[model samples]
Target: MVNVNCNILQAVDKNLMIADKIFRSRLMVGTGKYETVQIAKQSIHASGASIVTAAIRRLQINHPFEEKSLFKYLDWNSLWLLPNTAGCTTVEEAVRAASLGRELCKKIGQSNNNFIKLEIIPDYKYLLPDPIGTLKAAEYLINKQYTVLPYIYPDPVLAKQLEELGCSTVMPLGSPIGSGQGLKHLDSIRVIIENAKVPVIVDAGIGTASDAVQAMELGASAVLTNSAIANAQQPHIMASSIQLGVQSGRLAYLAGRMNELTQAQSSSPIIGISS
Candidate 1:
């Protein structure tokens, strides 16, 4: 008979699938907040992320697939492009941005790529996502055959609603945008993970590798972060660290963590001696 642990280990090593696309790496990096284009490029390389997201407006203003374009820095054939509607506040604006993002993807030679990272944030002070608007935009995008990965609050109800709406993934925020608070709503996120039919991606609020690890350990399908890697003093190194942390957490999850106990147990029990 086959060993159970070995069988589980093999199964755990399988590639991640999103909307019929297979990705070897579970980490997704963003092309924003880096001090320089070169640094961002290097960090992407270091992060081992198969999916790379770019703000649609940022791409349009910065050459839009020209020789100096950020897309020019990486191999488009290898790295999947995820166009994001970061600056859009309303459902109408977000839908339009996603359309523009599709055009941008076509210009970059990813003609069949229809992935969009939907963000609908009406509030500016906290930069929290607007759930109703996000759902509206997601419905529009999914109807248009675009793979929608929505950034939302870690509300289990909202998560289930999005999944029922046919989203590719429900990206529940760990904290506010670029806040680095590191899974502030972890308990809610855990509930989402437990109940989600689609993948649960912990997006934003990841300050470092430990944050990524915790998300993975909690059974998050993946972790998406731009600030943690881009804003680091050593971005490339931080990127690598996050990559390792994700791997470690995934392995630990697969191995199955020991159950927590109210009482402590000795690692090695001693034989009773005559008292």
Candidate 2:
């Protein structure tokens, strides 16, 4: 077999995973609303995602006599399930959920390298994170040896605080969840990225492939999205599109950029050398 050394292949090998000892498909997706679990699995496969987030809640427990479990619907070996404290509105709730996430992962035969996707949203209508509560929860979880990746506003100060508290990464919202606003906080996102020592993932509010590309181009380490891909007319196609977009955007950022100028380029006859 001929060795294929392409950018796509390189990205698949290099940028596809993270620092938390997890092998990911690079494009992080969510286990959310789909017509069926089969559809969700297909979409995740098409998106080329190795890291999929799921909510860790009491409501998701399998009832007695249920034929199929949620784990049965996907290739668990190929994916890292990041449990989130989705409905948490306070520090206590977030911490409790994180503990439960670790326990559940262990029970499911996952490693002790516990990684929790932390979210503490006090506002029911807006679903914005309670920044103070999130910070407190992050501090507690990180101290307890959990790799915390909290979803928060695009606030650089809060990001710094999280880093100081030993968070693995900071996941900032591009806009509101399911808003499809496509990086409304570009400036703030840029600031967070530039200042972050750890990975900065743009989570939520990404509407399309271009949005993912733009976020990566702006120096975001990764993008975590759900509604944009899961609710697409054709989820599989959208997943593929997002996977490509992230790779393209990351390449562009690494390849460097050109400076813009007011003057137009001189094709010929500008000075001399007329043949």
Candidate 3:
């Protein structure tokens, strides 16, 4: 058996609060896009994620005999089910989806069914979230006593608005959904992170471990990913690496990173060195 390091365990700060629920892991994984349920389970286990996102879609009644439901694979007791309005284009549709998600969670014995990841994506090509629709939906959900976590663009003004509107968290995309382009709007994301009072979660466009690390380093409370691990050659390994990367970045942020300098500074003593 391989020896485990106790120091590494002590270094990780595993407490994360989202919508009144405490999650041990900072990384949230998506349940879609995996090859199989077993593979998804393995990846989720390796990721050490306590929260998993699932899209709100109609169950196929035609194939009632076949086991096609995603819920069958999920362990509701351990993982917090975050149902998302991924394909909804309008505020009305998103609201309906959110309601359905809540009902579904209730059916699954999830008592704390107030959490929802609101996403209104009208643009199919870019898969960019509709800020106007998102804000409208968020307002509706918050009024309904739901803990809304709206997925939005990297706009400081919008993030502030969402926080003011009583959102549990504001999830801004680093880039387009599943683009793996990383933080294309770094300045705007930084602005959002700095200004928002609620937890800022960096969602989407994270390709690998480095992308997740960069997000955490930029002061993101958490990181959500899907395609980056699901599409990788080894999903389980990638998930584990991303988890470690997120932890390292969070530790670095807490430790206080050194300021950047334009010129290189000498490490050795110049007076003692022979010319």
Candidate 4:
């Protein structure tokens, strides 16, 4: 056996705080659209993500197959379950879904059940989140003492409004959901990250590992990805790659990247070099 240096791999102090809960991993994966629960579990475990999102609409209360239940494969002790209102089209529906999700969590004995990923997308064609309805639902949920993470367009003004409304985090989309466009509204997202007091998470349009890195380098507190990994040929490997990408981006950000220059400059000692 060869001796290895473990100090180099020591954990960094990059804890993500949402409401009162703390998570060490910044990458949040979705448990949807996978071929099987085993694949989803393996991918999630390989990704090293502490938080995973589940669609409340898809979760079956009474199913014929026990393996089909998400709870069956997940290690509830380690992973934080973030139930999302994926298909809700209105404020009322979203609010009800959130409440039901909380109740389900309670029934399942989950500790952090008050967290919700609020989404209200009435338009099916574009699948764009309805900002007005999202705001309304967020306000309602916040009033009800829920730690709401509202998904909205990459609009700085709207992000600020959500922060003002006491949302735990504001998740702005890079592009439309599942489009994999990869940060189409970079300027708007930058503005939101710069101005918002709460955490900013890039919620969608991540096509690959580079997309996740770009989002993190742009100062996003975390990133939530679903289709990118789920649709991959080998999801478990993709998940691991994405986790590395996120880690690299976060380290780069913490290292204070150099400023961009208009012209190139040489790094040699001109006086010592021969003419």
Q: Per model, how many backbone clashes are there?
A: 0, 1, 0, 0
TM-score of each: 0.93, 0.90, 0.92, 0.94
Model 1 per-residue lDDT tens digits across residues 1-275: 22233344446678778989999888999999888879989999988899999888676533575776677778988899999999888999999899998988888788999999999988989998999999888898898999999999888999899999999999999998898889999899999999988888899999999999999999998999999999899999999889887877778877789999999898875778556
Give a tens-digit lDDT track for model 4, residues 1-275. 11121122235534888888888788999988899888888899888899998878877744412766767768878888788999999999999899888876775678557999999999999999999999999999999999999999998999999999999999999998988888899999999999987889999999899999999898889999998899999999899888877777777676679989999878775787767
Clashing pairs for model 1 are none
How do the residues 105-212 of candidate 3 rate in per-residue lDDT, one tens digit apiece?
776778777799999999989898998888888998999999999999888999999999999999999998888888899999999989978889999999999999
Ranking by lDDT: 1, 4, 3, 2
Estimate the lDDT of model 3.
Answer: 0.86
Off by over 4 Å in 2: 1-13, 20-24, 62-69, 267-275
Q: Which portions of model 1 miss their true places by more than 4 Å?
A: 1-11, 61-63, 272-275
lDDT of each: 0.88, 0.81, 0.86, 0.86
User: Model 4: what TM-score?
Assistant: 0.94
lDDT, candidate 4, equals: 0.86
After superposition of all CA atoms, the RMSD between model 4 and the true structure is 2.7
Please report the TM-score between candidate 1 and the true structure: 0.93
